[model samples]
Target: MGLTSTASASSEPYGHYYDEYSTVVDVTDVGADATGNEPITPVLEELRDDDTLLVFPEGRYYMDEQFRFTGFENFGVVGENATLVPANYYDFAGPQYRLFRLGVSYSPGDRIRFEGFDVDQTAPDTGIRTIEAYAAERLEVRDVTIHGQHDSGTWGPGMFNVTDPDGTGLVDQFRAPDGGAWINDTPTAGDRWRGPIGIVANQNEGTLEFRHCWLGAFPDNGLYAANGNGKIIVHGGLYRNSNGANVRVGGNGSEIRWPTVEVDSTRPEDRSQRGIRIENGRNITIHGAAVTITEPEPTSHAISVMNTCESARIENTRLELQGEDVNHGIVLSPDCGEATIADTTIAHETAGGYPFWIQDSDRTDRILAEHVTITGAAGDAGGFRDGIRCERNNCRFNYVDIEQPGRSGVNRNAIVNTANELTVYESNLRASQHPYIDIGANALVRDSALESSSGREAVCLYASSTGPAFKKNRLAQGIRDLGATDVTTWANTYE
Candidate 1:
């Protein structure tokens, strides 16, 4: 009872709205074990009430069953210096999945906050979800750390959602650094490729923000909040080594800002480790991201813009990739809509891949890349790799610099475009291989410097190409026109 007086919402993660509750009950004072000897699930059921705060004192609390509640006015579980020991897979009660189902999707709670619980799932085959909450109005989950490799094939650490469209939620500093393995590696799941995700909010319908959350490599994904029809904001997080995609989000008005995604390792069953995947969303933005993949899988990419995405904006992002595998920087799918990449740089020294791979998309789906820098080939490419491979039509690059050094052979180039209505304006394109700039039909290369390091042709118009225009450009080893018709060149220094 003495420890309950020192509890205050001022030191909480996002606790400006918590009111002063009149009743505060200690779990140990109400027939609960503090020595980690007995399960406290029954006592928690009895202690559940409205407009009250249940504070766990300094001790290890063991719970084999879940404690669920919903549709409450004001209820909070505060555990400042406490550790929750969950039972293993076979010994856990009920569904053997989650430990706390605070508010389900149907009977959502109001103004719920669960804070300061350090979960100890260190036993063999011991892993459970610490919280699965769905608050209708205000939800705040903070300072929850799960110290174990979630190998039990259950749900991951946390799952939160604000049920109402007008509600808001915040999950701050929830660190689950020791990620999980595949479901085939665990004992509970049978023959599954992937396991649980780190923090899931797929059913969210309101505004939810994840701030400074650190997630290690999980087998399934890092932050799987991609399908919810709400505003999901990830502000300042370090999401590393997760398969599929580290931080995958898609919703209306969603944003991933100041995120650091590192893929330095891979599991045996890991297929790909994508940095950020945006799908099934509109008006999405990824800003100020540092995506570094030192160890990449065969299909791994830094950022993937799926075809279901309506529009996206990637600005002020930096990508550094180094590996002996085929990994790309930013991949735009074929059916993707309008996209914008601005103030971004990609340093790809991988085995083979493009820095920017704009697939063969529809002509109406335009793309604009401005102030981007791409330089690589410090390591030899395994195959033909270009700095930018634009196969889609109606793409534009403005004030861009690409220097792919053809580390292995002369088959590589700076820009290889098979698309029509292409424009490269005010850019510096340099390649160590022959034909520094390879062009297709109906393209304009204006106010740009094109050169090759091996003293080869600066531009190569394909034989099948029809129209190409070069104006006011400094060319080094002049153009090699391979039967390209309607070739227009004016004010171009052919040196």
Candidate 2:
């Protein structure tokens, strides 16, 4: 009447906690203690079966060792108002690492479902991995939360991987908000500053989707699912402060959308916590994401498109870079293949950095910024840079706006182009100290408004820079030519 303890409790009505059609094998029915006293590793080994459902009915299930099973056809493990308490590092059994390792990369389950469990790792030196699910196809992990910090420095909370090329997975509503400490501070013997990650899927080879997951700070990276030959889609999550990048992703056809990434805290041994880092991949896209960095270092940018990417696009995104240090907003790496930033706004309110810095790596480059706006108060930016410091070739800016007010700087131009063959069309550029656009060779500016609020030249032609055509632009303080050859201008209104 209270709780059914039948040995053959298959397809029987077992209280309101389960349905009549819920054919399950209760852990207590198979000689497992539900009072959180003894270890459940022995009970799980005796009761684990294929094509079965293992249910943990309402109690604290304690685990002192890892429960590993692999190469199953179909399996499911669900808990009803259950809490899994793992033992401390010293008291745990062999390896003392993870609580559950369902499948390995080589031999994985075909269909795996792990849902509805709360983990508690609050005691000293009592952190362990909650789940490491490696399924070949059709994985569903939902509504699992891990409470307390990870101080034992084993593995992180969760790791999910789809090991086949045709596999698909979905991990939904997985939240671990307490984060973790560094490895040096924990009982784990290491000198590394980072302890573990919140969740990882680095060995994935199939399509994996994470929806509405929340992860807080760890010494290492947070939500790092980047290094794999699979497609990773992060849809609507909140990823906060970490040492490296908060949301570091790399895969072909990967997308990060509607994610709120913020970095407001910095540890003592922390390096840089960039908001979003596209480490390496092809055809990656970031859309409708908001990244805000309040406490950042020199390398902590809102978004950094790294050098090993084939192509990346950022559209309809907003970035806010605060602090009194040198922090950039959106940086396009030098060797990254053809980038596009469209319909985005970057507010770089830092001390000394550019809102947009297309790096000056010595290679042939091409980038396009369309319908983008860059505005902030970076008057004392380092190197006296501009709002857009572009040192690449064959770049184009269409319907763009760059208006960073410079108060005390030597070269705070609106756009500084040091490379060849740049084109600016139908844009508005305004600077406070220097020229609006530093004209290089083979440059073209047409149908634009170039203004200098500090009464400087609208266009500056460097020495030995040849072949520039300026047509139909409203120049504020006119052009300043310094020994330039083959300079051509027509229908430009000089003020």
Candidate 3:
């Protein structure tokens, strides 16, 4: 449908919400009538006061190197099924065509909604980015698909080396004089280097929401909203197979933050590196999501909870570790804030090692896990041990089931408590290959079952100061003191 003929516009939709002097112009009218050289600025310059530049439906609206939509609030651009196409400024001089590239930059709080459009970057300005919403506030980019597919490079080396970034990051910035300038373009440059994600609200304290959209293969991440205290919500979309993480929040060295990433994958990856990674940010929550990542060489963990995160919650999620040589289900390193893992299942190790590995950074940190199941598949042979493993003074496991098959299979323990004051209640640990009772300091094992190989000790209490208490338990062979602190058993009978 054409923008002006809408029921709202026919009866003066602008009159109800806007002033009389408001201008409405369809960007399709700016094209070349004779197919030669036509500048689109004059058509945009005619924008009157309170005017809404209604971009027409289903047509390519080309832009010069740098199209500036600035200093205009209460007047915005709205279009459906419209594509804002960007091109480079080519200067024909001395038989060689020199290319100048430009990017689209906008002001803050510009209530603009770019819906059902594809921003194409198949031109020069290989370093050109699509929409830079610097100082922008409340910009909503929905149902917009953006990709950098064309090759545009001058000489020398380019900024995006898709294969390897050497030391520097994937993206580098350039100063465009008039939108189209020869950027760092080379043979080994990355694809999707031209078009950037539509809306980027960096350093601007505005709320940005990306819903039902496909944003991928860009030079930077699909959506990068950071620097300032901005709320970013990405829901019902597919973010996959990119140079960087699907979504990245919080920049370098900048701590004390609150950012949220909520996703429900349409298609999942078994070997996903890190679904939602938090570096120096507080109050991060991920709920009801399934992440399947390939465990490529040097396999990345499913989730890496880094330093000083105040509150992190992962609920009703499934993490399948499908990697090659390296894999850790969840790596909770030192000095973590407060972490909670509830109602989750982890299975099928494509690579090597355990199901859940928790390494400590500092002491006295807190972790609570409830109703989590850790199991191994056929590919997961012998050394697939330790369901819940943690360092001293770190974590607590409740109502967890860590099990393995026959004695010929590799040993696996239910709860490997390496931390002090750790407690495991109402859980079952039955492994045929390894010992069942793997305890550390001041740990308490209550009302649980530890079943091991025939004739082997079911509970092997490791040497520590506070002898772990095994109460109301049923075991195959019973508890073994590996020089542990003290072994206390109450009304427990073993075979």
Query: Which candidate number maximizes lDDT?
Result: 1
Report the C-alpha lDDT of model 1 over 1-495, residue by residue, as the tens digit.
Answer: 323443565764323433555557778898789888999999989888887778887899999999998888778888858899999888898987788888788888888878888999888888888899999999988889999899999888889999999999999999899998789888966845578899999999999999999999998899999888999999998999999899999989899999999999988889999999998889899999999999999788899999889999999999999888878899999887899999999998888888899998664677999999998884434564778888888899999998878557545688888888889999999888643444567889999999888888889877877688999999898898778899899999988
Write down the TM-score of every candidate: 0.95, 0.93, 0.73
Which model is ahead, 1 or 3, in terms of TM-score?
1
TM-score of 1: 0.95
Sort by lDDT, best first. 1, 2, 3
Q: Which ten residues in a row have the lowest lDDT in candidate 3?
A: 156-165
Please estimate how well model 1 matches the true structure, expressed as its whole-model Cα lDDT: 0.87
Quantify how close model 2 is to the true structure by its C-alpha RMSD in Å.
Answer: 3.2
Q: Give the Cα-based TM-score of candidate 3 against the true structure.
A: 0.73
